[model samples]
Target: MSFIYSISANTVSRRVILSKFFKQKRLYSSKRAIILGIETSCDDTGCAVVDTEGNILGEALHSQHLIHLNNGGIIPPIAQDLHRKNIENVVNAAVKLANLSFNDIDAIATTVKPELPSILFKKFESMYI
Candidate 1:
């Protein structure tokens, strides 16, 4: 019953999040579950929690735009480090804002795409703290 589109940031300009939770096998009743999403491909760290019905529970995002803008370009190492520094807090805040804890998340989703290297993908897949 919660339908909110929320976000938090330190240096991000804008974000447009639209994705659904990955389907999983269910041996029990057809109850809805939640998915947490993390994005840290380029210059921002974004997190969101959504339900099976695609309602956004809560979200938090941190952008390194000013840093990149000041630096004159997007440096991969700097972007990675910034993601490392802020991902934990961002994820935590999103779950908190949703009035839930990590355990409440039935599934997790993150960015893994063409432009990002394996390292970044690994971070999104393995690192949540």
Candidate 2:
């Protein structure tokens, strides 16, 4: 199994990273790997479960886009608070949709710095690590 946790807001960089993941997967494991990905970099909190074969087992997203839009723009404190409130539910929903518990997951992937808020990082760490 492999766990990739990092921060990169660039789409091109993300694609490159994912490509490398697939190539390395072949060198590292014989069995398909199940990955649970969590994203709380901004106003939205999201989670997804997927396998190396490009199959999406489950996913959930909690968006605060409209709230931010109403406020004219994103407020970091508000976004952080919403993330705190919603992360657990989003993660559980994704796991439930996947028909698996945390033990069934092979690895966890998340954003750890730069783009992600400190509160979210701590929250996720406390929940999973």
For all candidates in order, the CA lDDT equals 0.67, 0.73
Per-residue lDDT for 1-129 in model 2, tens only? 233444367631121123335556667879787778777767788999998799999999999999999999998888878888998999999999999987667667765544445666566657765
Best by TM-score: 2
Candidate 1: stretches off by over 4 Å: 1-25, 114-129
Task: Kindly give the stretch of ten consecutive residues in candidate 2 with the minimal lDDT sum.
Answer: 11-20
Clashing pairs in 2: none
Evaluate model 2: give its lDDT.
0.73
Name the TM-score of candidate 2: 0.75
Clashing pairs in 1: none
